[model samples]
Target: MRSLAYVAISVQLFVGLQCQSLPAKVKKCHYGDGKCLVESANALLRNFPKGIPEVNLKPFNVLPVRDWLLVNDSQVGGAWYFFELLNQINYGFENTTITEIRGFDKDPTATRIEIHGKIPRLVYKGDYLAKGRMLWFVDINSHGTSESDFLNFRFDLTLKVRIEYRNNKRYLKIYELVPNIRLDRWIMWLDNFFPDNEDLTIAINNLFNRNWVEFWNELEPGILSLFETVFLSLFEDLFEKVPYDDLFLADEDSK
Candidate 1:
């Protein structure tokens, strides 16, 4: 009876020591092959949103925005450069709320990740220089005429992303990101052009309302490109901040 009692106490001590060895922040996985890696990946994602404030992006600027307002350069007699400033702009995404995170698959070849979230808004507020197009019905041409405007809007976004690990570095390639534009209190303001005219403001708003689909279609490519840039760099930075051993610490058999 004395020998059996000693064995039980020894076993308990070993278990306790093992549990205490893992870092408190990371949940250790003890069973099944690949479970540790999966859990580690999940942990990485769970910690991802916390690092958003650290992901600072250089202002994304696209010049002479392709197919902007469906107006061609030749149609304006190659005078697009002056008006290019109207389309050339800086933008960013903010208030991103991640609703779901999945795809830490056990299969090594499985490369897909699905993330669902709401981006509270896309922000654009700045100045531009444009020489007006008289033919295309744009009658304004000056330095500050088309300057100082702002836009805030929301979208329900789902991201299907592909990832690859090479040379100990991970690369994320965006597969698809579908953003459904939401109409919840969208704010659009053009400060100097039509600030006081109620009817003209409504008319302009009605124009956007009538052709919002086209507007979204025009905006999608640039928005997605900017998003991919921000997130990829975000994950890269996150990985640098988080160590591999800390994330994937596991017993040899589990690996």
Candidate 2:
């Protein structure tokens, strides 16, 4: 695919705020893949095709949203939902709730990471929810010995998060984001025309799923360019209803 160009869309014009100041290396996450988008009823619906949803400048300056992610629904006081994070996301719950984690059921440390955030995982301890009209924070305090580089670092960070109901999924820049469920089906349909070569099936599936990263890497530059244009476009369409936002993470465990 073409390298993401030096594209710079104004936050105020497109998103309407500079929630946080981000480092140059950070790239914003759009509303697709890797789980974690929000379910805001018609909030996303109003933003696409029919019209642009009004930006909630209430939390006006959230910047550097890292990855797509949402606190597990079970812990969000109700239904199942997710938030998107760009990279890895870490959470730090409030101490007041440290002894009273009533919102979440399982212990954060003990719960199994089903898909490493590709799937829903509870957000219990190290983070705060963006509900009830108050600003919440997620803290990242890590130590790299001074002998290595600058001073040890620790600080509070803010991120954009959303609650997305599976039934209520939506996306920005897209109207519908149902996965290319037909891609595999199409391959199978085409396969019927080919002989029943089990080896070919295995090879193609492997090429498309497991090794596709490398496979994509080897595509002619021109082909890759076209592929990304079509691929990201499709993704945006399929998942258009999910609430979209960018998040920033100082480190993996801090997301």
Candidate 3:
């Protein structure tokens, strides 16, 4: 029954999209700025290779960010290059201005890679691919979204490369749950029907807390950041010193 209902609703949405004209060519994302999803993804992949590894010949983003560091192995700023790759890869819906760039020219530390720019988009918490095996070696996502013309046309897609290095050799492959998705119809359906569905909202919120504490711990550490930290304090470690002592008058007679 539920499956049939979903099919019915989905059909209605598709038909509605086909009938209504998309009013504009802009949409804002949690990442801020107004640009269609497909366009932003395209911008990211297209520029991935520009200032990448030393040679920049890889022409793909399959390697773990760490492994991609090797491409710049022969020069300084190799580690920074690794970060640059991520910056481009995670480009959310933001302006074309420089966001943030912090790293050593030749050497940098992991604890603090350094960051610049106003990164407003919350990182997509869940749905990471398999670790050792590069499933999304070649990610091709299409968004049939229309910011201007709403004739149910427009394709914004991206192709990302993934690879693994073993025994000093490289292996490459593609990964996807569904290789092809008709996002135009999907987004329209989601926008109208599930935008405020309680169950769906709960599911997305669950992902937010799934690793929430762990992420906070990474920012501040020690005995204070234990798994029990939630009970001990709500971000107590990050609190600034109160310095209430200064507020008191030296002449205890004011009382």
Candidate 4:
């Protein structure tokens, strides 16, 4: 019966989406415009989780992981080119609720949303391929599987987003996302491998956590780029299901 209800709801949503006309393109909202965009954003976010229960990516979704410093050759006691670690992973969040939204009061250009929820689970199953040289011999086939998981994480993130519009659609680009992620109460597993030679998983984890700030600094660029893609995709997909006018306000409504 519960499953049937879910199917019914999904169908209703699909029908509702199909019936709505595309929102008309309006004048762009500028910084500190004191326009209706802010109010519209708030209204749209408050109605979240009602129509947007989950957001995810499939295993086929290419999550490119490049320029990641797995373990330098010197530290790993060899020459390791943790070259390209493509994550063929499927992950997302469920039961999401937006707690608050700020900065849009005057500056719609820089807006922030406070979100509280659990990313039900994340399955990162991918290949750990690399190349290394040890003892004058290069092991080009440094290959294995990399699997990780976080059963249920209770955390909050402050998503700083930059909004843009093109062709009648609102584009939200994440400028900075500060997460107060609490995985301490949750069991997170990270099982990375590199052939039968050695299991440097523990050491690798420690190195990254050793200097939290530096670690994030070294990887921020790559991380931010990945986030931009994910967020843009999510917003684009969202507007597809929900009408644009329903999410943002028309210029005249602002005043």
Candidate 5:
């Protein structure tokens, strides 16, 4: 009787594993159907904030970044700057809206997917260190807490994936990810810019805010690289647990 009970438990566990394929909330799209793909992708994003336990994904609403650095040695407005941020917490991705999706209509064997999206606002809080020289005369050195609010940020994401066979099922393995990001406006505040001089700190903050475009031009590369790393990890976690066949159903399969 004990041996028979052991067999029954084993069979139950196997059946449970087989049933845990994809999250129930995920709407499977037909292969090469862009409209359905968009809807499916949006549904997936909505689930990402709370996480899909079936796929073993974690909440990504607030992502933590260790550190990032930007250096502008070349002359720009008669000033050159070096900035570094540490222990950053980026917020607001849970509010993202996918404006367009492309390359999904390509052949199933194709390896590329392009996605465009916007985040109404992104808030970053971190510790910052900055050093710079202005007008070939004035030198600036500061380190303190900083907060930046980016409004109307848009991004174009490209994902490169390859097929892999696991347990006789096909799955997508994301090998590379690239992102192009743009911001419409920025609000920045840094504490202790001049160390105990409130007036200087306020002035410096205003200057940075007013000239944010130039600053963004300098920071864009670093920002893109950061997003590439973060999103790649996020996608890998989702794709590895889900089979390709489960994600995009064929027409007959949909029926």
Candidate 6:
């Protein structure tokens, strides 16, 4: 019965999206105006959670992930770890604030765009599996549920785009997206690290929460890659539906 209800809801959402019109609240910014671009970005972020149904985008407040694996062959504190998160749900992107926009005033023909933004907080809850050897002696293996909070999360994004002519209209295609992400602090909780030893599990959880910076440093690369993939897909979805002229105002149109 639950599965049937879910399917029904999904179908209703799809039908509603098909009947919607382009978002009227979207404010097109002048091509070379940094301030306007920043404002436009913030506006889009505010609207992202509810989704732009005209573009077939779903709500982005909660992002679901099947699994992510991070393997570190190099030693950190004389230890190497393999970590994986499964069935994860990440939240809080819709509250992001655009701090600055750059590279927008470059040559009119330039294909690069740079953006900087920050989120007050982001939370992730999921199942985690990890194993590692420490100091060539302690063998660690664990699997259970985990929740992690990222405070003051910030990111710098660089996008490379190409112009596409389709149906006599010009569209932007994102060819590459690079993201640099950081956080002021991380708080983590993991259950059942050592299934047979409750005290050991508590100690391990404490150790991770106390020294999250080290763990974040080790996890940064994988996390950045994950963001790139997710954001790229989102950008492509929007760009494919909205023509370039609809997103940015031309010189004469700006006036």
C-alpha lDDT values of all predictions:
0.43, 0.25, 0.25, 0.46, 0.78, 0.78
Question: Candidate 2 on 1-255: residue-level lDDT in tens?
Answer: 233332344433343331223223334222231232222212222233222222222110111223223322333332333322222222211110111101111121222111110111212112222221112332212111110000111111111222333323222242221211101111111121113455653464445555444533443343333223322432333234223333322233223
Looking at model 2, report the run of 10 residues with the lowest lDDT sum.
93-102
TM-score of each model, in listed order: 0.45, 0.18, 0.18, 0.45, 0.80, 0.80
Q: Give the per-residue lDDT digits (tens) of candidate 6, residues 63-127.
A: 77658886756546657888888888888888989998876442433745888899999888999
* Candidate 2 local Cα displacement, residue 181, angstroms: 21
- Which residue pairs overlap in candidate 4's backbone? none
Which tens-of-lDDT digit does each residue in 80-105 have in candidate 5?
88878888888887888887776643
Best-fitting candidate, measured by lDDT? 6
Cα RMSD (angstroms) for every candidate in the order listed: 13.0, 25.8, 28.4, 11.2, 4.3, 7.9
Give the alpha carbon lDDT tens digit for every residue of 1-255 in model 4.
999999999988866544344233323343333334444344443433233333221122233333333443443655544434455454443223333334433333544555444455544556556566645555545555665454554555566656555445444555666555434222222344334434465655455455545655564455445444544454445534443344444546643
RMSD of 6: 7.9
Off by over 4 Å in 4: 1-83, 95-107, 133-140, 160-180, 185-232, 236-245, 248-255
Ordered by lDDT, highest first, the candidates read 6, 5, 4, 1, 3, 2
Residue 132 miss distance in model 6 (angstroms): 3.6
lDDT of 1: 0.43
State how far residue 101 of model 3 sits from its true place (Å): 5.4
Return whichever of 1 and 2 wins on lDDT.
1
Instruction: Name the better of 3 and 6 by TM-score.
Output: 6
Instruction: Tell me the tens digit of each residue's lDDT in model 1 across 184-237.
Output: 333444334344565764575567656656765665565455444444544444
Higher-TM-score candidate of 1 and 5? 5
| Candidate 3 vs 4: which has more TM-score | 4
